[model samples]
Target chain A: MDISGADLVRAAAFIGAGIAMGLGAIGPGVGEGFVGGKACEAIGRNPDEAGLLTRTMLVAQAVAESTGIYSLVVALLLIFVV
Target chain B: MDMVFDTVSIVKAGQFLGAGISIGFGAIGAAFGEGLVGGFANCSIGRRIGMASPYTRTMLIGQAVAETSGIFALMVSVLLVFGDFSANGVCAWTATLSAGICMGLGALGSGVGAGYPALEAIWGAARQPAVGGQMTTTMLIGQAVCQTPAIFSLVIAFMLMFRNCVGLDVWPYGASLLGAGIAMGFGAIGSGWGGGQAGGAACEGAARQPHLRGPLTTLMLVGQAVAQTPAIFALLVAIMLISIGPTEGTILTSAAVLGAGISVGFGAIGSGMGNGITAEGACNAISRESSTTKDMLTFMLVGQAVGQTPVIFSLVVALMLMFITFNIPATLVGFCALLAAGISMGLGAIGSGWGNGATGAAACKAVAMEPTQRPVILTLMLVGQAVAQTPAIFALLVAFILMFGNYTGPVTLPAAMALLAAGISMGFGAIGPGIGNGITAAAACEAVGNRPEERGLYMRTMLVAQAVAQSTAIYALVIAFVLIFVV
Candidate 1:
């Protein structure tokens, strides 16, 4: 059975999209976890700083999450544009 | 679709794909390692303005050394892309793809692992400018040891690229070749990372106690050596798989052979990393209190041994799959079962092995902190490690059942898929629980060490947490059973 070039390219693009999302998520996941853990430790040590720590943690996590968002964009491009 | 090549399109496609994969994965580790060096070097330089020149030199040297495996991968990719393959057949196609996979994955671990030591060495040198020379030496040694797995991967990649694969049966032989690549590539990752961790810890320890640099280096070497055992096992399996020249029996046999490679390759990752963590803890412990180096070494070895169990189980399963010839029909169901069994065992081992290492590391630290609580710490660690091992044991049982169970059903696609799903379910299910249990164990050990009087309370609390964590693994096992039996 012979596969057309268009068909093969399409299949490859889909696979690439999936792989991009999968590998891309790993860094953000790890980064966010570290941020949250440190924040919790800080809060525990100084309960008066709980509000500040939580706000800082969320901001750090959001920044870390940017990479994951970029991965998603790339994946979308692969799926739709490519 | 723009322009289609005539006769050699398939081989050309394979070559191009292989090249892309080789460089793509190769880039990840080296870039990460260099970044790590750069980041830490900047931090060190910031602390001491007078040390900027030396720190920069160390960073450059360390980054260059970490780039070695990446360079090896690039060489293979260049060769794959520009090399002639017009006269080759399907065998060459498989060979190129396998070679790419081997080099790409092999470069990953060593690059990241090597970075740890370099960064630590630079950081250490900033603190203790007097022992800068010795710290640099230790860093180089650790980074070099970490690269062993990558070197093994390079050797296998070279073998795959240049070997005479013209006369072999294309289909079954192709799977075996691919399996060889997967085994060597995945196997190298954990060992490289683990060895680097041990090396980095040693450098840090040496910086703290320049007087004990000799003992620190000795412990680092031993730890790195132990951490490398899993990668060695992977190399052995990959070599054996590569040597299996002809496809003998049927498609089922091919599946089993390929499954064997998958089992051994993925299984080694967790074990290598676990041993590395244990070694890192041991190095730090010795640095803190040089008096207990002998006892700490023994404890580290023991912890590493327990962590090695999951990989050993994988090895056994892999060996059995490779050697044993089942006289079953060449049905899709049989093929799925064989392949799924390997997947279940390999993936299941990862979390358990890593979890055991975490427990061991904690226990090692606790022992160093309170020598008097040695008996309680050891017992608690063993118990926690054992609990962590349960998910892997469950996975092994499921793998065995999948491999040896009778399949008297019709050759339906659903049945084959169900078997495959069962493996996936159990394999992925076991990972989180194993790690979670290990975390619980580590915390329990730390608590027990801090207050030896409350050992019983901590032990009980640890067991409860572990049991809760283990529930998810049980659910996965049950679902896997349902998939295999009911579905």
Candidate 2:
């Protein structure tokens, strides 16, 4: 019982893509933690600033989220496009 | 059997590897980043438990944004795990490595970098509640800048995966693909860390000294620009490796190809971190001593230059390995040697860079307080940095032996293990010396910065302590030598 050359490659690429995404998530995870930590402190100190702090946190978090997004795009390309 | 294998299986393995890397590492950065933000937000919720509803809405919005990237990674992982491959065999396998590495290391910087400013901004809001708008704007802008490295990584991943762009023959193409990923991934680590350091420092600095915000921002940008060097260097290497055709020869060259990636990738980490930490130190100094800004900048730049040395060494190793045509017999020993080259250089550079970073950080702080002690600071810095460089040298020695050793006998796993052991011995082993030397140098710098009159005492203590610290690295080197030659 044996498999072809092509099948071996298929298996590797699939594994590789998963690895890429998992690794990619590392960036966003750490970045979000920084944001979340700061947001809490802001509310604790001055609840009145909550409105402004919340808005700021959201915007900054979005920007932080970009790397993860980029990873996704790459992972997708690996899966379907590559 | 003509060495025929289930080629299909190999390709499938590559895909699975890529898929795991993309989602796994990608999800990591975002989660941590979200945690940083959420933890801070929780503090707000704790105080304003009555206003929890509105706070929760805001928190969700921020969280949702952070989660978007995770979702994207998840989607991609699902596709890779289940999708049909348009290509197979070598191409697919290469793509997998490329794609996986592209995102794994790439995401490292952005997540960390973004988190720094986000953390700073939240803290800034707490301190000067009125300035929430200003801090938020700064955080967003700064975080956006950090995203550049990750984007570059994504583009390369696309090229490697979708375009099937690794053009050389299987051997070299495999080398380049792997190199490209390593180049981007490890390259980003230092830069992201540096960017975060600079941006975060500036945020805190600006908060404390609103009058000097402009200068602080400029310094942060400058520091970040310097941090980008390793990533840029990595990108160039990756592209060059990709474009070059495969060399026709023994497996030695193929090993060189793989070695090229590891050498540069690991090498860049040190320089990036070194430069960034120094830059942050300088920024910190500036907050304390605004009048010494000019001198501080000079010290910072000089420290950066010094810190980047190990990366240059790595570049040399990569270039030499890449362009040279070694003629070792195609044996397992030769293969082990090739792999050893990378591990030795890469890991060696890691310690050196980190050591330099410690030195650079101390140098900046010293120069800020005691500008007059510049001579002593510079001298001790160089001396300590040189000591830190010893571990890298040990790695180099091992690499040279692996490359040009006299081992034409029949290959055995034990012999090969000796070679591999030598590499690991030096690579992981050097870290102790590298870090110890840096700490030693930094401590000296602090003394000079604190009280120039006590220079002699500082020097003596620093040297003595450094010697003690260096013992571990020396032991590593001895073990490495034993593994390579005696074993």
Quick one: best lDDT, which candidate?
1
Enumerate clash totals for all models, in the order shown.
0, 110
**Model 2 per-residue lDDT tens digits across residues B257-328:** 778788888888878877778877887888777887777777778788878888887777877778876667
Q: What is the DockQ of each candidate?
A: 0.05, 0.02
Model 1, runs deviating above 4 Å: A1-82, B1-7, B86-88
| The 10-residue segment with the lowest total lDDT in model 1 chain B | B460-469
TM-scores, each model vs. reference: 0.85, 0.78
Model 1 alpha-carbon miss at residue B364, Å = 1.0
The prediction achieving the highest DockQ against the true structure is 1
Residue-wise C-alpha lDDT for candidate 1, range B1-487, written one tens digit per residue: 6786443676677778888888889889988988999999999999999889999999999999999989988999999999966465557777788889889988998999999999999999988888887788988998999999999999999888776766566568777887788888888888998898998999899898998888888888888899899999889988988887346567877788778878888888889898998999888888887878879888999999999999998899888888887656678878988888888888888888888888898888888878888889899999999998997898899889988888987766656766776777677667766776777687677666566776765675566556655655665676567667865
Q: Which residue pairs clash in candidate 1?
A: none
Real contacts recovered, all predictions: 0.00, 0.00
